[model samples]
Target: MRDCGRTRWWKGAVTIADIKSSIGELYAIEQLARGASAVHRLHPMAKLIATAFYIIAVASYGRYDAGGLMVYAFYPAVMMAVSETPCRFLLRRFLPALPFVLLAGISNVLFDTQTAFFIGPVGVSFGVLSLAVILIKAWLSVTVVLILAATTPMQDLACQLARLRIPAVLVMLVAMTYRYMGILSDEAHAMFTAYTLRAPKQKGIAMAHMGSFTGQLLLRSIGRAERVYAAMKCRGFHGAQRLAPARRAAAADWVFCVCVCLFSVLFRVVNFSYLLGRILV
Candidate 1:
């Protein structure tokens, strides 16, 4: 009985720790954006455009074509290394998007049994290839966006969106959402901490309490936002979000954007992986 009690507390600690860590991760990304790397200095609109084109190219690959898809990894890999973003941090952020991707990709393995190729004595099926392609694409897509977010401040990115003629309402909505995410996370973390302290022997809040638990978190966050809104308005804050003075994209920014997009398109059409495989043989 003592052992069981100790185990519950240990698990509860871990759960609370995870919530705290999530709050840290949100701030960490914003902190990294303050760096002065070449990638960081590129005009936000240019980076946004380049990232969009890269994602479109990545999504164009067919489900069964893992060979070509494998070669598209260079964009994220080079971007992270050049931008000096932490690979492990980016990988951790990549995980929350994985479960649904895994659910969909795993089905291919069971449903697709026709053999497409053989590695010596081992046979590989189209389903297996498709699954591999899906997982790789998910990682690539997530990492590329992370690269963009890690290097660009939210205000700058939001301003870029506004400049690009993204609807002002939509831009403001997105900016507010991004700004409030950290606040909400902090509120949730505090609630989680309170629960663990009061119920020290439980591994988590009781399943029956989960709805109320979540509701409480939502209510607290809404209240906090209301207070903050009132405080800001008292200080002569209107609805408009002011951004830094706009700077036009430089010659180098154009060169970098055009080069990356062109390479992405070229890579989409040519299977560099197949070429390398043949050369090795």
Candidate 2:
């Protein structure tokens, strides 16, 4: 019994450590956005426009165009290199969305198994090709968004949205949600730590207690949000809260945006990967 208790205590400690680490990771992108890299210095709108174009180009590729989509990988790679954003951090962020993507992609494998191509000895199905395309699209799409977040501060993003005349409610929600995510995580961490201390013999909050734990967390978050809203009201926060004005795009910003859009167009229209294979052969 004593050994079992000791094991549970160690497991509880590890749970606490995980909570603390997650709280830190919640703000890791914000920290990266504060860097002085050249990518970070470009106007936010330029980056936003470039990202939009790149996403459109990626989505335009057909299900069997996995070879063409490979060229789009350069955008995220170059952005990460130029912005000096850590690959590990972006990869960690990328993983959570992958399961959902894989679940959707796998359905194609099960349903559309007609042969699309063949190797020297084996046949490759259209389903397999589609799955590859889905994975590539998922990676490219998620990585670009992560790069944008890592390089551009959330406040700047909010301001740009407002400048674009996006509805006030959406703009406020985006800003407030981004700002409050860390606070919510911290609250969860604190609650988790307290639970661990109180139930030292428990490996984690038991399934029986999970409902109560989650309900209590939601209640706490709501109460804290009420207080925060009150404070904001006291400071002149109306129904609409616009962030700082975005700076005008400079010549360099224009050049960067044009270059990114052109690159996306060139890769989308011309199958560079196919061309390279032909040249090699």
Candidate 3:
């Protein structure tokens, strides 16, 4: 019975080893749920166009335009709600980029000598207001990009880029890199799990071991890439991955695009405060 127990323990250990070995496949499974919303059904090119226009408008406007930046957020907020992307998930993802936004906003406080108004004893400096504008604009731009990425498959995005006259090589590189990132993430996770299981608790991983671990990962990745390439070649791959082109954009997609563009332009060009002052007069 003692011998049988030992054999069973070893068998369980081997099963974990097998799971770690196939970690890449596991990671790919996780990515399947990333952008599973109905927004994905919209035309990829239309999404790309709207994203590009939004970015340009935000970037081109004056950094002191707080009203403009506030208006810009309305579009993305509406889209997020309508697209069915979980707001909590989007917020979580956006948090990482917040620090950099704050850093840039700090510069506006330090510089820009223009004074805007006074809040009680505290004078409202144009510089500080500019900083707020920058942060808002940056947040809105990032949100749009995130939405585009979440909704569109990487392959479909690449195809859209290709149709937009972007270099084929660049499109291919982006497509392949995006596709393989999940694979590498899975591989790394599996390796770490296996190493943890085998190593003694008292002799935990050290910083010095990372170099060796990274080297091994690179070697394994290279080997896998070679096998994948060979398999593709065997199946008549001709330098580019083949995919069926997406269908034409429907009327609904065109309507969505037009509405977004018109609203964005109006938001940027029209000053509601000035209009309100005129109405009061």
Instruction: Give candidates' CA RMSD values in order.
Output: 2.9, 3.1, 8.5
Write the residue-wise lDDT of candidate 1 on 1-281 in tens digits: 97687666666554645766786787799999988999999988889999999999999889988889877888888889989999999989988889988898888999998999999999999899898889988899899999999999988989999888888779988888778877777777788879878977677666667799888887887888799889989988797766677798899999999998999988987888899999999
Task: Please write out the lDDT profile of model 3 over residues 100-203, one tens digit for every residue.
Answer: 98887887788876789888988888989888887778788888987787677677889988888888878888877666766776777677777877864413
TM-score of 2: 0.90
Q: Per model, state how many residue pairs clash.
A: 0, 0, 0
TM-score of model 3 vs. true structure: 0.78
C-alpha local distance difference test of each model: 0.86, 0.87, 0.73
TM-score for model 1?
Answer: 0.88
Top-scoring candidate (TM-score): 2
Give the C-alpha miss distance for residue 142 in model 2, angstroms: 0.8
Cα-based lDDT at residue 19, candidate 2: 60
The residue pairs that clash in candidate 1, if any, are none
Q: Considering summed lDDT, which 10 consecutive residues are worst modelled in model 3?
A: 24-33
Model 1 regions more than 4 Å off: 1-16, 232-242
